[model samples]
Target: MEIDYSHIKVIGFDADDTLWVNETYFREAEEEVGKLLSHYETPNKIDQELYKMELKNLGTYGYGVKGFVLSMIELAVELSNGKVSNSIISDILNIGKRMLNKPIELLEGVEEVLKTLSKDYRLILATKGDLLDQERKLEKSGLIDYFHHIEVLSEKQEYNYSRLLKHLDIKPSEFLMVGNSLKSDILPLINIGSEAIHVPFHTTWQHEKVSENETNGVDYKTVYSLLEILKFFKNN
Candidate 1:
């Protein structure tokens, strides 16, 4: 697993967990909804059921508050035995919209690292989520200026890695994917012959978190923080 860092021309990054504190915001919103629904169902029951719907909906509908909102509405209706009104569903949608409009917070040193990495790499954002939602987040984050290109996709499956590379007119072996989710970001790129750098986060959404054993290739490595990536590159 020799990496001539010089050969790496384009670096793709995951947006949510990798660049900013996205999951915590979502979790907070979900908790609020869970509390609101607790009189009808247990908190654990509401959370578990909604999460199950979310996982399935993501496969069909994709990331963003839309699917999550819908799942919450569906779960509420189910838990309430048809007693949940359209007003509750509408309320959930409004809440999801508000969550998207919330302020953005970049992880520590994210701007610093992006500023540094922007100088040497052809940095591209390769995040998957609702297009408009992701775009709004990027616009407000003040970090969009550092990237050369931005991709908002439905998922980061293996074909997605190839599609993004081809779209950029780069070879798979010449690209690098840096992200927090091993399941979504690291392994898919590695499968296609690209290298990956994993910068772990502490409070990942259950859907986004990956077990360490999920690292598919021998070439993959994890850093405790994003800044450690620079040291790794310098040493390598």
Candidate 2:
């Protein structure tokens, strides 16, 4: 689909995978937890247990570190045949705490791209995350100044996107959503009569990855890298 960048006055972006290495860190922590739990059960068994607990937590507490950490604790208890001790749970909680302490690494050349894009468009970060964790990440990333608005929602449903557009007083046709998640970022925007740009990431969170392409009748586009978006802006 052809895009006239000039018409897109407001551009919204998904934060976690788009701006920083979010899922990779989570995956690393999970691997560590798996090793710890492997003493009680095989690696495959540990993974299966964790996956089941994760799904159960998603239904109960939704997304974010709290849910993930709790799932780890619950899985440990189950895998250890109810022999899990407070020390094991404390160690698991410490691992989750250390995740927030992990340094935020901006994707390759992402800062430069955002700096250039902000000059020409109204950039607003529309991220779905745990409120406090998301806020701390933005503060640490040092990219907060580039956004005119930042939203941390429980989920990125079409309704939330519509409400955001309404709050910003921007037309659907005049807005654009850019991010890595096909489920959270791309589909919602396309369904709402807005333009969407899908930026694929290598290590997508299992919950956020789209299983199939559903942009057949939607006004959507994809680019290999975030820097490639600069091609749309003309020389001034």
Candidate 3:
């Protein structure tokens, strides 16, 4: 089925893995945390338990390196029966700090895609994470100038997208979302009657994984890279 994008006036981009290197760092941090907690449990067990902790605390900590770090600490204490050492706790804190301070490495053709598309369509950044951290990344990305509006959402759901569209005074048909997560970025927009394009990253967070049944018959385009998306709007 060939979809039409002629009506899309505002293009929304997801900031993290979709535009820059994000989930990769999370994976690395998880590996580091696994090693740090190996004394309490096997590496695989630590990894599994840490993911569970993150999910358990999602509502409390929301999403970001801060939340992730807190989850790691909680897991350390729990797995070690409150006997986890201060030095190990300190190591966990440093891991989060390192992740927070990591440089923004933009994905291939991110600038060219944004630069070209911004010339014709209104481009807005719609990403969910720690507002401060997201802002810091945008500022450092040097791509902030291309966006007309920036939204750091607490969550990405159908209602959230609907509210965003209403706030922007644009119909769902007039908006298009591009991102990496099928759960947060693609499914929500599709459910809200908006268009979305999936540009997957090499690594995905476990929380973002969606089953095939969830995507069955969903009418969204999956492009291999950001540069490939330019073709869809070539005639515009």
Candidate 4:
């Protein structure tokens, strides 16, 4: 099937792993947490149980470093049978704080791609996470001015995108989303009749992983890097 870009007037970009280094930090934090909880369980079991706890707490905590940190603390409590030490919990808190304070490291070609695309299309930042955390990264990124709109969504389902497009008065055919997650970025946009481009990151959160069969019939393009998207747009 052919994919079209001529009708795309508004282009949405996903933050976090799509634009900068994110999942890597989360992985590092998880490793530290595993070691901190090593007295209670093996590293493998810690990871597995942590993932399960994340799923359970997703509704209450939502996505972001804060949620992840809370999950780590919860897992520590559970694995230790309420015998978790205050120092270990404090260390976990420090991990989350460090993540929140980490510098925003943009991926290669990100600014160049944004610069080129902004000149041709109405660019928007449509990432999901804790609002303040996302805002902090965007501010630090120095790429905020390149976008005409900024939206930090709580979720990225088809309906969420649909509501967003409607709010912005953008037609599905006129919208395009670029991101690293197939589940949140590609599938939702395709299902809502919008175009999407997938730029996979080296590290992905387990929650965002999707089976090949799940994306079998999805209409989207997968590119190796953000720069490749520049070739897809037509010159006005």
lDDT of 2 by residue, 75-135 (tens): 9988888998788889899999998788888887788888998988889999986888999
| lDDT tens per residue, model 4, 49-165 | 999999999999999999999999999999999999999999999999999999999998999999998887899999998999999999999999999999999999998999999
Among these predictions, the greatest TM-score belongs to 3
Q: Give the TM-score of candidate 1.
A: 0.91
Looking at candidate 4, the ten consecutive residues that score lowest on lDDT are: 1-10
TM-score of each: 0.91, 0.92, 0.98, 0.97
Error of 4 at 151 (Å): 0.7
- Candidate ranking under TM-score, highest first, comes to 3, 4, 2, 1
User: Each model's number of backbone clashes?
Assistant: 0, 0, 0, 0
Q: Of the candidates shown, which would achieve the greatest lDDT relative to the real structure? A: 3
Residue-level lDDT tens digits of model 1 in 1-236:
64457778777789987888778777887888888788798888878888898887777778887777878887888889989877777778878888878788888788888888888788999998889989999999998899999999878889987987887898998888899988888888888999899888787778766665675335787888888777745633
Give the range where candidate 3 is weakest over 10 consecutive residues by summed lDDT: 1-10
Candidate 2 error regions (>4 Å): 213-218
- How accurate locally is residue 54 in candidate 2, as Cα lDDT from 0 to 100? 85
| Model 4 regions more than 4 Å off | 1-3, 234-236
Residue 57 miss distance in model 1 (angstroms): 2.0
Kindly report which residue pairs in candidate 3 clash with one another.
Answer: none
Candidate 3 local lDDT, 8-79, one digit each (tens): 999999999989999989999989998998888899998899899999999999999999999999999999
Model 1 lDDT-worst window of ten: 209-218
User: Where does model 1 exceed 4 Å of error?
Assistant: 1-4, 85-87, 211-213
